[model samples]
Target: MKLHQLEALVASADAGSIRGAARSLGLSQAAVTRALRELEANERLPLLIRAPEGITFTEHGKVLLTHARIVLNQLEHAHNDLERLRGRVEGSLTVGVTPWITLTFLAEAVRLFRERMPDIRLELVEGLMAVAQPLLRDGSMDFAVGQLQPGASELEFASEAVLTYESSVMVREGHRKVRARSIRELLDEDWVLNFAPDGKRDLVDYLFTRHGAQIDERRIVRAQSVATLQTMVEQADMCTWSPTILSHVPPFGGRLRSLALREAFEPRQLGIVTRRNSTLSRAAVAFIDCLLQVIRRHARSAKKEDLALFKTLELLI
Candidate 1:
């Protein structure tokens, strides 16, 4: 089928109707319908069913739409590559990052990247791996920076471990439970936790199980935003497990303190994740370099206590 026909099909699927697709593509509704009909005629199968409400794809249409998206994504990538070959990094770059990384080094990396490639558009999405993975697989994101979980190597993505960092149980400063010596002793207090499919939730549960304590789901408030977690810890008698870097940053740095739990878990590996076998744009490569540089510089000038803590946790830099 013609490229225009594929474009019509994909755009209509995205917009939910031929008229909406025409508006998006700056074409007439009749033209969009004609292109879609031509595609169906060529395939000798009904692609979509038009209705007053909108349009619904047939089973065969659903399969074709998936391939159409991949083709369109590849075409866009080719255009970006051509621009890069002309010695200009002037295309859009979408990146996904975990909250801790966003707070620690992502802002600085973005600033430096903008300075070097001012014409390039940058989109930053902050969330957990469960949210970012789908975007990466669907060609909606260029790359991601976050924690690498167990069994990551089995996935269809390439991951490069940059550093390993420790996590701690944090509580409001001067809270009565700050001096609690054991995990079981702090179980009475409510907990604010990051809500991930199998990431932070699993870690919290593992901590309780390892300490021979049953997890009290009723006392847990699951959240994904760092700001919400901080507000809850500051205003309520609640605690959370956070990256050591977060405990060293503002609002949290002075307002929160880590509990001295008797049991210590292994440090988590932080890194970059990208779709395997995909060609990256020059802007994406440059941004990844910028991130690594910032992390290395921060590691070098880190405070002695911070270095000692990383060493104590057996973290790799």
Candidate 2:
């Protein structure tokens, strides 16, 4: 099947409707439908189940959709690389970011990168670190910045550190629990924990688990993003762990009163990661340099902000 057919297939899977897929690719609905047919014929599998509301992928269709997306992303990047070979530093670069970084530092990096390379197509995919690693391996992403959990081998080190920062219990200002100086005093208070699919929640969980404190899982106000968790904490008697770096922001710092988590509630490491044993394009290398420069400048200017981090040498080093 043609690349356009695969592109159309992937788009259809993404948008869940022929009309929506057409809009995304700037193609007519009939054209997208025809392309999907062509892909289905080539694969000899029904790729979609049409419904009134939207389409759903059949079992085989889901497999094909996954393969189709990987192929289309690579083909698009290949086309971009061809353009770059002619001295145009232009191509799509998709990066995976964790929710925590997505809320804070990513905005600054995106702002600076766009100014320098406006033509470089950018895609930011945000999810848990576990979900992002395979995309990095399959060439769907050029780089990623997130926390590294145990046994994540696909992600090679670009530049990262044990980025140390104090943990704070985020609560509304003037809340009674805010008066607690230590986590011990606040133990009986309600907690809004960021629920992990498996494993511990945060640095607080790590410390408490190590010290044999039972994490009251029932007290958790499970949330996927910091904003949502913060919102719940603001409205209710629950509190969440807010990294000190985030507390620097005015609205977060002002509206949310932070009580110390205890001495053991040290900082978690935030690493800049890429696929292991993978080669980066020239443009990708340049973009990584730009990202590092941004980080270095931020580190230098905000030395007080830099709590305790292990700065490994550059990836090129």
Candidate 3:
């Protein structure tokens, strides 16, 4: 079938109606219906069902749609590969990052990269390391920045030391625990827990659990979002464990005070992770190098105040 026909079917499945799909594809309703019929004929199976409410994809249609997307992506990659062969770095790069890192070094890295290489497209997906790992393996993400974990032998990954930092109790400006530098004083308070499979979550949970002062898992508010967690900590008395890196920047360092946790939560390793075997485009490689340079610069300029901010993120270079 034609690419347009494939796109039509996929769009129809996504939109759930010919009219909606037509709008999405910038085609007339009759044109969309014609394309759907052509695709159905080419596949030798019905692709959509028309009902009172709207249209729905048939089982065969769903499978075809999945393959269609893969095929389209391959075509785009082919085009990009040709562009690369011409020694032109002009395609998009998508990087997955955790929220705290997004608020910290990523902004600087993006700014420097854009200034240096204006032609390379950029995209960012911010989330937990657990969620980002699979995408890295699937080749969806070009690279990521997360904790250096134990299982590097299995994946194509390269890591660099970013920073080292300890855990601290974080609360809104006026929260009572903000004044208490001891874990005991903060234990009873509800915590906005950061619990994921990565080192940050693991180390924080390990310390609290071992100390017999684990935040009430039942009362715990599991906020995977950095912005949400920050907002929750700011609006309510709920406390969160943070890396000292956050204290490096203003508003972040100045707005929230991280009282030292009494328990010895070991310093977590923070770093940049990139696929080892993957052939990075020149643009992507350049961006990564620029990011490493930025990390080095930040490290040399690391002031006591910055470490306080870096502590919030465990940022090291």
Give one digit per residue, the lDDT tens place, for model 1 in 1-317: 98999999989988999999999999999999999999999999999999999999999998888667767776787898798789866678889998877766788898889897898888999987777777777678888887645566337678778777788888998888889878898788899987556565566667787678876778888876878888899888788887766766655667888777887866777778887777777788899889888767666667874464344233244
Winning model by TM-score: 1
For model 3, what is the alpha-carbon lDDT of residue 301?
70
Reference-based lDDT, each prediction: 0.80, 0.67, 0.70
- What would the per-residue lDDT of candidate 2 be over residues 194-310, giving only the tens digit for each residue? 544564555455646565666666666567766677778778767777565455554465677767555356556666676554555555666666666766665665364443221
* Model 3: residues with Cα > 4 Å off, grouped in runs: 1-81, 148-161, 179-182, 197-205, 274-277, 302-317
Highest lDDT, which number?
A: 1
Mark the regions of model 1 whose C-alpha exceeds 4 Å error after superposition.
1-6, 34-50, 56-70, 149-154, 198-201, 302-317
Per-residue lDDT of 297 in model 3: 69
Query: How well does candidate 3 score on lDDT at residue 230?
Result: 79
- 39-80 per-residue lDDT for model 3 (tens digits): 898879988889878898788877777667655545665677
> Model 3 lDDT vs. the true structure?
0.70
| lDDT of model 1, residue 289 | 87
